[model samples]
Target: MREGSPGWARLALLALLGSILVPLVAAGLRSVLWALVGIAGLALAAVGVWWTLAHTGVVRAFGVALTVTAPVAVLALYATFGMLWPALLSLALWVLALTAARTASTRGRTASGQAVAEAPHAPWVLMNPRSGGGKVGRFHLVEKARAAGCRVVLLDGSQDVTELARRAVAEGADLLAVAGGDGTQALVAEVAAHHDLPFVVIPVGTRNHFALDLGLDRDDPTAALQALSDAVELRVDLGYAADRVFVNNASFGAYASVVADPAYRDAKAQTVLKALPGLLTDEDAPRLRLRAARTSAEGLQALLVSNNPYGRAVDAGHPGRRERLDSGQLGVVCVRVDNAAQAARLVRGPRSPGLIRLSAEEVVVEADTATLPVGIDGEHAALPTPVVCRSAPAALRVRVPRRRPGTRRRPGTSRASGAAADWPRVTRLALGPLLRQRHQARAGASGSDSGSGSGSGSGSER
Candidate 1:
């Protein structure tokens, strides 16, 4: 069974209980010994890596030393842990289970490739050479685009991307593609939507969250080039906060403040730590008024509005993945507390008491200041107070590779939700009839045996 299924969950619970109880009843010392051995193996591996990297001895001699001993040490540790077969078996089984889950989840939903290899018009690709540390140049994206018959435009930071996209569309570019960060993707996607051109995402960004959600292979930008040949067009929603468009999410309050910090990009942890003390402790922190659904809150320290709702469970396979992109609603999360303790608790569990999370077609955030600092798709901006966020459902048409690497559903799509909701019924329908037949057969057999015994007894009396 796939992970998180009822069968798998039951087995996991049993294993966990057995692990705790069986040790107490028997071989307690052996379990402790195995734990120690595993810890020792990890420590030894760390030491090996450090020694091989940090030692300043004779170069060739050090290489020889590491080359000779590292494998031996690893093998020794493996042998100490019962010949390593069990570990290998466990790893193989884990891989098999993961593959099964992915396959089961994507059975009939994933797009398939057809051998057409045609484009309506030459595609214009907007590439930011500076995005993801010059990923375009590093990956030879221009050469690849040329090979794919795409007209490539290098964004030199001089021209407005929106205008550039407009010009491309005017000049007979039927399809729009971007090889840049989410910020650039949003700008180009907006233009694509306005022109009714199919959009393609080349994930050359630091996060590429939008691309990831689209089920594109974020690891390899070249993989997306295949969409030009064999593609599947999917209609997805876009999120707008004020005049700005965001592909992933927009953030207000704490996250916005942190991203707006001058040193945040280079020193994220330090910047957050420095900003947290004042943000949490200041009683005069600007309170944000939020109205969504039937919930109204004032003085919320932070607000996050996503294009689609993220899964509620922290341990879900894909925690922040949108089940479907055309959900037609904005996922809003409100943080009511301004204290560090509350923040810590939230990190410990997403279901912490002070968090109010919900999905809505629109969310309005009012602030005391004339302008509120907001982080839109990881880029910081200042928007006028009373910021209105809304979902533009099916606003953009995205061209993705046929047989996309990881095809999954978005949050609010009724079909996906209905499938999940109807799983219990489906399972019962498949098994319930067989169970009833078995019970009837067993009961009939018992009745037949009783009748046969009564006849035998009557015959004996005669």
Candidate 2:
């Protein structure tokens, strides 16, 4: 069926209803009870996993055992009761329904942008050969950029990037661009913003989160080169943590501590897993208090402040992705899972008190300690407390290719802010056309009756 059509909407609504009802109809009331039990078990298992990270010795072993056995026990209960098939079917239908609902609601949505008439006369591009496993060398970006009438600077790890950007600006560079990670991107972007020059992004970074949000093709770094000839300028916001600018986000608490570890660069996952326990349990560790937009939160274990609010739909294939960069607001997510019960409650998603998600124009992060370890766009740094993170609305002008992959919203994607579905909005969208048609039919009938009565009266008078 065609997307955004009445039929598609009806199908989505039906699928959503069926995802809940099918289990009950097939397996009776026992299925409902079993499902609740399963959810609780899974929540407990999550708590157990946290325990395994935060504890050592016998308690850790118990946590490991519980984590392994809880889900298995739930499965065993389902198998014993002959409800496994129905449970699996319900889950599959739920996923399908979510996908259909998201598509029906968010179709035809696009980011706000304006056309750029003039191209930069003197563009300077920086290429980091080691950024994404030597993407510059593989793509031959330096040669391509120079051939396109732009001056190219290849970074060799010695010279500071910010200084390089300033030097380029002094030498009459009209546009500044980077072919590196978000940290490097932020540096050049800041320089470009300071000089009021257009900034371009080449998605040569391993995970170009900034480029992805701008709708640039991450797979093809060369595609970004088209911005020089044919482009649109997007006035996007930049995030600042104190004086430092971040293109993506500033992370504090547990995550920042992990990033500051010496072993993180060589072994990231292992480092995080090893560090989480100590960070979570250390009482003397600096407790953070966050204040923003008339709301305040304290005792936060982890906090993430982003340049723009990220899309909330976890299943939309783009978690931690921002739909628009021009919102002029910072996305703040604070986590404070203090105990097993709090960890278990996370199954409620956004409703859980353990997680606080909000948006504000500015945020102040104060800690009990004199200094706070922060991860700014994946780079680690130490900042003095009460660190201030604020949005620099329309501070940087970004020139992107007029035609790129991310410019259009893909089907099955959502712009929702969190994991929870906005069912009310979905319902309205799903039933809107049908409701309008019904109202029109009733109005037509009323008009026909009025006309008929008037005709009879005129006949009698004649």
Candidate 3:
């Protein structure tokens, strides 16, 4: 169906409404008895884990028994409710809801304020052959970059990245690029910013969070190479912990401790599981002490300081994504739970009361130890106590491809037929028909002003 047609609009409205209600309806249709049983089962499991951790003799024995029984209770509830179809249907409905919400949200969004410039005549790209399971070799990024008129530098074990980037700029390379993780990106971006050159990102690394926020195609490293020819540069903020630059975030406390482990890369999940419980429960005073204008806390389990704030709520639409990278404030989340009970409650619910969230231009942290381990954009390092962190506003000029995935509509454009492009917007769109109906009713009743009312109402309705 044609997008502007009445039939198409009506269909879109219905689809949007269905997407909004189906998940709620499916959840409501679930058996309340079985639901309560499921909750009990979860609570029991959590209690068991907590007790085991506490290690009181009788409590530990009971905890083991409860842990063993919790799974049986869950399986029994599944069988009682005939959960197979309902489980599958619930998953499908949730997925549909997310899709609709994403579609609706992106419609109202616009592209970042980016300057149009000529692509550099002489571009230099630094690549890590070992990043992302050797994505450089698998994707043939070096060959692709060279073909795109880039001078490629393979990052072997010998050379320092910052010095290499500095050398490239000094050698008259007009543009600098990195095909690795955020750590390498930060190194090269720092040099590029110092030299006032635009930087390009080729996301050939594990969890390219910075590239994802840039709206680049993380799945295709080759598509990122297109930036060498397309000169769309966005001015974004950069975060600094002392002299070190981090593109995404720098983490302190428990997570830092975990990442600092020499064997963490070999067994990430296991290492975290083993390290986290002790990190949270140990009575020794927390090494990291945090202080900001709006907050003061000690013994924080972890603190995350990001270049830009992530969305506060964990809903399907945004899913911890930062809406804008240009915000001149750092996003901070601090977690401090004194006991296992608090941690269990946190895991069982949406958010813990213990979470301290804030945005600030600067934050100061003092560690009890002489040196503190910090995780900077996934790379680990040890920095001295009393670390000072700050946000540098509009510090970097990052060049992206002209035609890239997840590109938003520009502001001040006509939104007459703007349908939702992101899932959260779908929820808003689902409410539109009812709002329009109310407005029409009001317009009809107020006969003298009906013309203006109806005309104004119709514009948003469309």
Report the Cα lDDT for candidate 2. 0.84
State in Å the error of residue 198, model 2: 1.3
Instruction: State the lDDT of candidate 1 residue by residue for 252-319, as single tens digits.
Output: 98879889999998999778756764674467767789988787888888889988775442323444
Q: Which regions in candidate 2 have their CA more than 4 angstroms from the true location?
A: 1-9, 107-110, 313-319, 408-420
What is the per-residue lDDT of model 3 for residues 1-462, given as tens digits with 9 covering 90 to 100?
111223333344565455445444655644555556666777678767666644456866887788889968687667665664554454465555444443344322222455555678899999999999999999998888898889999999689999999888889899999999899999899998888888999999888878877777888988988777755777888999988899888999988989999879999977876676667676774556888887888878789888877654323444325656777888888876666567456544435665777889999988778888899999998888888889998899888887777564323111222222333334345556668999998877788587778899999999
RMSD of 1: 10.2
Q: Each prediction's Cα RMSD?
A: 10.2, 3.0, 7.6
Name the better of 1 and 3 by TM-score. 3
The residue-by-residue lDDT of candidate 2 on 399-447, one tens digit each, is 9898888745452122422223445667887788778999999999999
TM-score of each: 0.69, 0.92, 0.76
- The positional error of residue 251 in candidate 2, measured at the CA in angstroms, is 0.7
- What shift in Å separates residue 183 of candidate 1 from its native position after superposition? 1.0
Which scores higher on lDDT, 1 or 2? 2
Among these predictions, the greatest lDDT belongs to 2
- Supply the TM-score for candidate 2: 0.92
lDDT of 3: 0.73
Instruction: Mark the 10 consecutive residues where model 2 has the least summed lDDT.
Output: 411-420
| Model 1 misplaced regions, further than 4 Å | 1-118, 312-320, 340-350, 408-462
